[model samples]
Target: MRVGDIDISYDDQGDGLPVVLVHGHPFDRSMWAPQVARLAPRHRVITADLRGFGETTVVPGKTPLGVFADDLFGLLDRLGVERAVWCGLSMGGQIVMEAHRARPERVRGLILADTFPEAETPAGRAARHAAAERVLREGMGPYADEVLDKMISPTNVRALPDVAAHVLRMMRGTSPEGAAAAWRGRAERPDYLDSLSRATVPALVVVGEEDKFTPVDVARRMHATIPGSTLAVIPGAAHLPNLERPAEFTDAVERFLATVA
Candidate 1:
């Protein structure tokens, strides 16, 4: 689909209410294959590749979360979808939150996985810019090597070899320029926690029990803030719980969605 000047590659299947799945930074829509396959049987599942990632061509510039949200809203508009349940992980979750903040009427519910709403702290802002510079100087190899192990829990390294390799491939294949752009853009993202009370829609917060990035505490905090959000932690999984524990993640989402509409 053509979203503004860029072409967004997406998979839209099934026949119920729209449920859009957005992948994290440096990753593509394929990360949601597990959830897509399962959700396709029950609802209108849409998985999209964000700019600079997946098949989407990179447009050089600072791509803010608001811009990403606009692209998402545009994608849905082109598809004739009025509203959808926004499901996102990590960076994608931030996009969903921003999109909801910008256009609350367009979001039916939220499925935030391994994500948080706090803006980057002073040290984090510096690190993100430095990381972007490092990636540009050394390419994605160093960054990929550093994050691969941290992306998944130690237990998953042995138990889920395929999962580990999957993330590695995604990271390695990601466009360095795009990844750097996202990292820089994230450094400028605003904190969404303060106004979260205004988001009255049903939400499901899923995080890996062993997630080093967002962890269980952040998930609990998010659940407590969102009006009536449910929380589910996938045991032994790390950052990408949906990929590591698809069945459990899908089960959690299904139960939550069943209650909403």
Candidate 2:
């Protein structure tokens, strides 16, 4: 669908309560295949490739969290969806938070997984800037190869070869220009803790027990800050628990959806 200057690629399926799934940075809508398959049977599951990722237009420059959020709201408007549950992971989770902050009434609930609400630290921002430069210089292959194990647990990389391969393929195939642009934009992200704390809608925070990036403690703190929010820690998974431990992740989402309904 055309939203402003870009064409967003998305799949809208099923026929119940609307649930939009946003993919993380450097990945595409395909990352949500597991969740989409499970949730679409009972709800309207809409998965979209963010600008510069997946099949979407590669803008080659800074695309702020607000831009991503606006693109999503535009998509929802096109679909004629008044309000719906918003579920996202990593960068995608941050986009969901931004969306809720901009238009709280349009967000029915939030499902944040493997994500944090804090603004980027100075050191973190520097690291992101360096990564952006590195990817732009060396392309995505080198970085994808280096971070394969970090994206998922080392044990899972060994045990779930196909999943690991899929993860690697996604990262490697990502446009370096697009990835760099996202990194640049993400470094400027604002803290969303205040927004999450003020939210009156239901929230579900899911994180991988072995997530090195966000860690369990971060998720715990986020869960505690949001009144009446639930936290489910998936064991034996790393950053992408939804793919590494599909059943456990889906089960948590299923229970959360029941409550939302």
Candidate 3:
């Protein structure tokens, strides 16, 4: 669908209460295949490729979380989804929080998976800038290779052969400009703890037990702050728990959705 200055790629499946699944940095909507397949049985599942990732147009310039949230809203409005369950992973999770902050009434519930609400630290900001410069100058393959194990546990990378390969494919396919744009966008994100604390709806915060980036401690803090959000840690998985432990991840999500009504 064409939204704003870019064309957003999305997959809308099944039929019931709408549930929007947003993917994280550098990856596309395909990351939610497991969740989409499982949730579609009981609810409408919409997976979208945000700007600069997947089949979406890789427009240059900063894509702020607010802009991402607005784009999501535009997609939902076009689809006639007045209010729906929002499930976001990594950067997508931050977008979900931003969308809720902008228009809480449009969200029925939230599923923040493998994500955190904190702003980038001084060093983190510098590192992101450096990464962006490198990716833009050279390519994304090197960074993807270096971060594969960090994205998912080394044990899972060896145990589930396809997951790592899939991540590599996604990372390699990403537009360097898009990747840089997103990295810069995320670097500027503000802390959402205060806003998340005021949430009135149900939320499920899922994290990987072995996640190095956003560890279990981050998940616990988000759980404690996000009103009545449930926290579930997928044992032996890392940042991308959904891909690393699909069955367990699906169960955790299903458990949360069951309590929504």
Candidate 4:
């Protein structure tokens, strides 16, 4: 669906109540392919390429994260979906939080995967900006392999080279400007811990056991703050557990949705 100067591409499949799955940075709707395939059979699944990622075009100077959330709301409006259960990964998690803040009435539940409430710390923000700068200056190819190496578990890196290559290719496909804008906008996002604590929506937080980027500690903190939120750590996976352990990740999501429903 094309919405407000942007072509928002999305996949809507299956039946039952709507469940939206949003992907992280440098990835698009394809990142949720495995999840969609698994969950679409049991639930209505909606996945989209957040603007400037995948087949979506980049709007230079735009705050990608904010626009990304707006795009989701716009898509939901177009689909006649009044409310939905949102499951987002990494940058997608940030977008979901913003969306929930914007339209709490439309969010039935929240699932924040492999992300945090705030990245306001000097060191953390600087590291994010530096990574963005590196991507812009060096281009994505040179660092693509290294990034995938770190994001995926060592076993997956060794055994699933093709999968790793696909993720690297997606990273290379992202525009430098878009990536940088998203990084900067997300880095400056306000702390949502307080909001999470007071939220009425049922929330779940999931992360990989070996996730270095967001880490288990961050997930724990988020879980501790969000009242009654459940946190699950996927073993033998890193940042992109959805890709590395699709079945396990899907099962966890199913369990969470069932409990919340």
Candidate 5:
């Protein structure tokens, strides 16, 4: 259905408590395939492609975290869901946090994976803008080729060829305009640490042991900040742990859901 000017693309499956899965940048709803398969049996799984990615309408300008959050809630509203557990990875995680901030009453729980709440630094902001421009100019093929190893560890990339290929495919398939818009929006995202620290809802923080982008240290800091959050570290994965170490990642979510859902 259309949410504002964009037509959001989503898959809703199974029955039970609602669980919305948000995919990270340069990716789409397909990234949540493993989680949706496992969780749908026990919970309602809703996964959507953010604007400019996958099948969603591509708007060529800035798409802030708040706009992403609003789009998600608009989908939920149409589905008749009042509240649900919000789960996200990387940039998606930040969008989830933004959702909670925007409508705390609508978020039942939070599952933040391989992400941080810190605001972008001066250098980081500049780098993101530059990267956005580069993506616009050079396109996603080169960007996908460049970040494949960083998205998944080199060892895993070799050991799990299918997983590596899927990651690359998602990145390569993403719209350059959408990716660039997300980058610009992400650069101006506010620090979520304060809101997360004050959050009363249950949270689970998961990180891949081999993830260089958002390392275990960053996950630990996020865990410490959240009053009663659980921390799970997947041993043999990197940024995209759900695909690299599917069993471990799903197990963590299953365990966390038992308590909250």
Candidate 6:
């Protein structure tokens, strides 16, 4: 669906209370396929391609994460989702924070998976930006492979070839300009620790045991900041535990939801 000037593409399925699934940077709605399959049986699952990632192509000049949040709200409005339990991963987590900041009443609960509330430090941001630029300059093939290798556990990469292939395909499908824009947007997100502290809704902070991208320590700190949020770490997984260890990831989510519900 076209929301404002952006072409917002989403998959809506199953029944019950709404659960919005948001994906990380350089990937699209397809990245949440496993979660959708697991959650849709008991929840109204909505997975969207954030602006500029999947079918949702954005205008070249846009650079704000708030705009992406607006796109999410617009999608909810178009779909008649008044209040939803939000599950966001990485960039998706950033968007969820923006949504809570923008319209707290629309959110029932929060699930932040492998994401942080603030940008990396100046030096770290520079290093990440440089790496991203190198990826763009060199083309996505090598970078996509490297990204998959970093995102999932080695066991999943070698044993679950299909999962690894799908992730690489999703990463490779991203446009270089879009990927750069996403990285830039993420690097500029506001310090949202205060926002997390202020949120009263039930929340969950989840991470993969081997999530070097957003380590378990970061997830623990986030859990500490959020008054009542629960923290869960999926064993033998990396950045995307939901993909590498679907059963464990889904179980944690389900348990969290039971508490929140």
Per-model lDDT: 0.88, 0.94, 0.91, 0.84, 0.93, 0.85
- For 170-254, candidate 2 gives per-residue lDDT tens digits of 9998999999989999999899999889999999999999999999999999999888999999999999999999999999999
What is the TM-score of each predicted model, taking all chains together? 0.97, 0.99, 0.98, 0.94, 0.99, 0.94
Off by over 4 Å in 6: none
Candidate 6: tens digits of C-alpha lDDT, residues 144-249? 8777778887778998899898888888888777777777666667877888899999999999999888899999999999988899988899988888888999
Per-residue lDDT over 136-215 for candidate 5, one digit per residue giving the tens place of the 0 to 100 score: 99999998998899999999889999988999999999999999999999999899998999888989999999999999
Candidate 3: where are CA atoms >4 Å away? Answer: none
lDDT by residue for model 4 over 94-180, one digit each (tens)? 888888877789899999999878747988789878877887898777767677877787788888887787788788888887777
Between prediction 1 and prediction 6, the one with superior lDDT is 1
Clashes of each: 0, 0, 0, 0, 0, 0
lDDT, residue 75, candidate 5: 96
Q: What lDDT would candidate 1 get against the real structure? A: 0.88
The full ranking of all candidates by lDDT, starting with the best, is: 2, 5, 3, 1, 6, 4
Report the lDDT of model 4 for residue 168: 81
Cα error of candidate 6 at position 200, Å = 0.6
TM-score of 1: 0.97
For each candidate, C-alpha RMSD in Å? 1.0, 0.6, 0.8, 1.5, 0.7, 1.6
**What does candidate 2 score on TM?**
0.99
Q: Between candidates 2 and 6, which one is better according to lDDT? A: 2
The predicted structure with the larger lDDT, 1 or 4, is 1
Error of 6 at 118 (Å): 2.3
Relative to the true structure, candidate 6 reaches a TM of 0.94
